[model samples]
Target: MHFKLPNKYLKYGYLLALVPIFFLVRYYQSHDPEVNTGESFFPSCIFHSLTGYHCPGCGSQRAIHDLLNGRILAALKHNLLFIILTVVLGIKGYYYISKAFFKREVVDWTYNKYFSITVFVLIICYWILRNIATPPFCHLAP
Candidate 1:
């Protein structure tokens, strides 16, 4: 016999997948050394290592580690884009959960083209600025 989950139950499968991710992040929070300290199992950015230029995601691992440890500013310092997206995603998650569980009416922004374009532009700008060696842009380096 074959069993198919009902449509209403599909979302719960996604929640179950997040269980392992939550534990992994918790493990990283406590046991993982800072990625910036030059010792980590986390893979170094190949784009940066080979090119000697900061990639758009250069310090994201460190930022995630710091954010998990409640070091908000440190996370922002590592990757401003990551922090901004974290906040944006956090809000989106909150809204999704509230609407799903509580049956609240909500305007979903998930498919907004303008938001997508803005994020793409921001990433490209960040990738370029983070590689610059001059005063203001140098600080953008991870």
Candidate 2:
């Protein structure tokens, strides 16, 4: 007489829960005029309200928004690294989910020391270049 949920069902349930949250966030964004909720949320972007220097994740929101709105060029203009990272993360997430739910292993890339070092190097390089470079490279803020 006890109800037990399967792993797939739980994963889908979590996804469903996200739907209402997304709608609510969209509604709030649409309704609030003064609340700069998008790329502006990050204080490090050149276009944002922050007075100091730029942060590495500054233009990410605008990038995501532009990408979602079918403006690939504009999204790239905002933050190329952010967009690329998003795509990579999305692919990784899909692979992980499929493997977890369907018991099907798509790829056999192991996360080892080399992988960690590569990711760390990439992030550090991105951080240094974005902060020290000129306007356009600085534009890669997010």
Model 1, 1-142: lDDT tens digits are 9999885797888788899998889877875455345654677789987889998888888888898889898888889888888888988988888887788988877659998999899999999988889989898888
**Tens-place lDDT digits, model 2, residues 44-91:** 346345555555566666666666667789878767778768877887
Q: Which residue segments of model 1 deviate by more than 4 Å?
A: 1-4, 33-40
Predicted structure 1: lDDT? 0.83
Roughly what TM-score does model 1 have, to 2 decimal places?
A: 0.86
User: Candidate 2: where is the Cα deviation over 4 Å?
Assistant: 1-9, 24-51, 108-110, 135-142
TM-score per candidate: 0.86, 0.66
> What's the true lDDT of residue 132 in model 1?
84
